[model samples]
Target: MWFLPDGAGITNWPKGPTELDALVFGHVFTILTTPLPNNQFAGIVRGYDNLIELCKRVEKDYFEKVLEH
Candidate 1:
């Protein structure tokens, strides 16, 4: 797995050959893909939108419960 800093160039996914299984960059979660033309070797599993919703729901629930206490 590759844990890259946010804004790192991932379009040319993988960058090079290795035993990479997954990649986490910014709010994007990508998995290794069979190398293809255009340097496309990473497939996005989840993007910011999905993560935002999850975070929102969790925060809302936690805050609501806390306020009830």
Candidate 2:
């Protein structure tokens, strides 16, 4: 499993070989893809929208509970 930065612009690119890990830091987008028969690639999905919402909820809850003390 691997993670790409910003979903690599959400484009359908050709499949190739890579020897290095090309993931960037400070990004939380998980990419999923599939290879085609013609050496082309498909799928550049980025997820974790719900995680942002969850973080907001946790922050609100923490402030309401812990910060009040």
Q: Which candidate has the highest TM-score of all? A: 1
lDDT of 1 by residue, 1-69 (tens): 133333666665564323332122222322223345643424334344444443344446445689887
Q: Provide C-alpha RMSD values for all models, in order.
A: 15.3, 16.4
lDDT of 2 by residue, 1-69 (tens): 023334657475435312222232112222222344542221222344443433344446444687777
- Whole-model alpha-carbon lDDT for candidate 1: 0.40
The lDDT for every candidate, in the order shown, is 0.40, 0.35
User: What local lDDT score does residue 59 receive in model 2, on the 0 to 100 scale?
Assistant: 46
